[model samples]
Target: MVHEKSCLIDVPTAEHPRPAAAATLLELMHAQGEVERLSEREQLLSSLLISVNAVLWAIDWETRRVLYVSPAYERVFGRSASLLLADYREWRNSIHPEDLDYAERSLARVLEQGTVEDREYRIITADGQIRWLSDKCYINQQVEPGKPVIVVGIAEDITEKKQLELELHRLATTDVLTQTSNRRHFFECANQAFDTACAQGAPLAFLLLDIDDFKEVNDSYGHLEGDQVLRRIAESGRGILRRGDLFGRIGGEEFAVVLPGCVPEMALLVAERLGKEIQNLSFNYEGQAFGVTISQGLANLTEQDTTLDNLFARADTAMYEAKRLGKNRVLAG
Candidate 1:
């Protein structure tokens, strides 16, 4: 019998390998190593993106499509990332109505400026909470010659910082004791009102009020009772003044009011009402009841008054005159 010739060749071993076969095996090994390294790097990058607090996002400028958004997007925006990716208007709808125009214009400027760093605005979240964001965006510089423009941005939640700033401003501008405008802030606002009234050719009146025998009250009733009196007087003044009027505790026992567009008669009427309100407030200390009164001096804006200081000076003089004449009365300077 004739035997058929065997077609199978012997497998090459490492000790006795062909050159081409050896090269192929080495290439396969190298490719496998490269793929493993690449996968590890991808995992590390994903971990970093997931761990960050700020939202990282990308968008296709030409299509107005959201390309990618990191995990933090859902946490900060209180909205679904899937929805944002599905429709670009999801982002637009989240912007505060008052800041929509500004947000759009600032984002558009990034096309010409290459980067926008100082973009800050407010957004309404899905839960109807208003949050502030400091969103910075830049154009990708590695695009091909002809390709859709990609915009990348990082948005950081700055709501806490903004709230802190507002609180600090309130502390700086408001009196801690009486909850009215402090001395410095009162003058600042009064000066602005004075200039506005001058520009509009409107009548403005400044009224300075002093609590009568305030020192004696503090001595007789203790400092706590004196503080209560001050607060009650401030509340009464606030109740009597109009919306546009500026009231502030300018001194220990002195409060000032700047009435915009008020004639002399209207200012006098407001002062009288405030005085009566103060007089009606009864205080009790150690089972003893006592009441307080205020002396007020009113001054009207004149052509000779160049600044608020001039108006304030005349009112101050009149207030002292009221004190000298009798307490619990109003006098026009």
Candidate 2:
């Protein structure tokens, strides 16, 4: 395509009016060549921009109108650029309700501070899928004084990245053998529960339990059977516990349960019920039948309990007491 500036290239007025006119013809030819080269480069740049896997957009600061958007909008968000350009409010509406305020605040910050680093937010796509996007935006205010202050933004889909991150976190926080919360995550959850219980003045119960003869089972059968026993125990406990209760494996064959809104008596009842369920589970390894039992210690939240460690220690002591009294029994501290 020829530009208006390209059409103004001076050519020879006469066949050979003078040497100056001949020189002007040469200059026109050179200018025409340069314009063609520039046009080719522009086409290449446009192609690259459209083929990219990111959303490239420019918005008019004054009108908040979408000045330009790349074709990738359809590929990424399942929406047409025309729809966005027709009404910039569509862009705002596309943001997830939980993240709309954050997105707006980020834009406001860019407008106020004149620069912004990359920020991440979620969006509800046209196809009804949640997508994570990382937006890198900057303001361009160096244009003509009367012209609009433009904000140029590039947003890329990061949903896969976010999912992978969550998977890794789950792996880190969960027990590999029992599929329960690991020690560190258990403590993290317990700390939160403790703080909430203290703030709300609500009752909380802690149960520390140990599998009876776990080492003997591992020694008689292979570690594989031992793992199966642990998994079974965890499954049984989860089935017996409430939705809000927290159960985790704190050590080898040692597990803890946090029962929110539970008093000492209720906690003891839960422990007894869990022990009964475990006692009924029959373990068979190559036709050798056996059963597993758990000894539990229960403790309730008290005003003197300053930290989770204190509560956990009392429960642990009670658990040892149950073990000392006999196997497969519950004790209260």
Candidate 3:
């Protein structure tokens, strides 16, 4: 049987031909031992890479061709190494469309800089599932200046980690009962919107809503009924608001909405609709028929407004005026 010559096992060639006649049994045995040792070492390295969870790959930088990939490529990317190696475009096409440009820029930077630290991106697997991957790359040395050099890359699956982080952030920022942004998150988002509106000189509006006689509901029924009332209000208000609107539960019975690109008149219309929606909701607990109402205040961004709090305070004052005038109504500030 003819054995393939490997870099690990040194085989004699024409220039260094073996002295077959004078070679002794012990010398042959030693050479055989050395070959076996090197072969085992090569096999172990191959197996180590194949069995690992992360993808290991090397690519020709100049040609943008994949040179080597471990078996984990198939496991992580849901594609056989043969397909990726055959056409590098297949790998590029696997990246998510939203992330493709960013991924290309990252690779270009690494190639230009000769090294890159960790970077995260998303890719679409063969089965059409989106997965997050964090990878790093470095150029291999020992190549001629003008010749094609190799790039070594390693990537690991970070989809689960990213999902967990998203979940944690949601829990931290979302109201548990209403499933809307909590007070802190609401201000965070409102502040950002305020900054954008100021920079672009765009019209923006704020609405502060409060459930009328909420304490009466809790006192007459129970906290559970009050919680149900709040949930129903949130759901109903969300249904009436536009997709671009930002609505959140700012207090136990108070909610806020930030409407981008909305003027004073548009904000008043939205406040009226939201108030009507909440007033029309019908909820029952323990066979008791009860009704609730809401009061809303509307305010628009003004040149005099310096901070989100200024707008919020104006809306809050108008909401209180609404509550004082009538239980179910909207007042514009």
- The C-alpha TM-scores of every prediction are 0.83, 0.79, 0.89
For candidate 1, the per-residue lDDT at 88 reads 95
Model 1 lDDT per residue over 156-260, tens place? 999999999999999999999999999999999999999999999999999999999999999999999999999999999888888989999999999999999
Residue pairs that clash (backbone atoms under 3 angstroms), model 3:
none
Error of 2 at 284 (Å): 2.6
Candidate order (lDDT): 1, 2, 3
Tens-digit lDDT track of model 3 for 178-240:
999999998999999999999999999999989899999999888988998988888997888
Task: For each candidate in turn, give its C-alpha RMSD to the true structure in angstroms.
Answer: 5.6, 7.8, 8.3
Whichever of 1 and 2 has more TM-score, that candidate is: 1
Better of 2 and 3 by lDDT: 2
Q: Least accurate stretch of 10 residues (summed lDDT) in model 3?
A: 17-26
Q: What is candidate 2's lDDT per residue for 134-212, written digit by digit as tens?
A: 9989887665777788999899999999999999999999999888999999999999999999999999999999999
Off by over 4 Å in 3: 1-28, 142-144
How accurate locally is residue 229 in candidate 3, as Cα lDDT from 0 to 100? 93
C-alpha local distance difference test of each model: 0.94, 0.91, 0.88
**Model 1 TM-score on a 0 to 1 scale:** 0.83
Residue 122's lDDT within candidate 2 is: 92
Q: Which ten residues in a row have the lowest lDDT in candidate 2?
A: 3-12
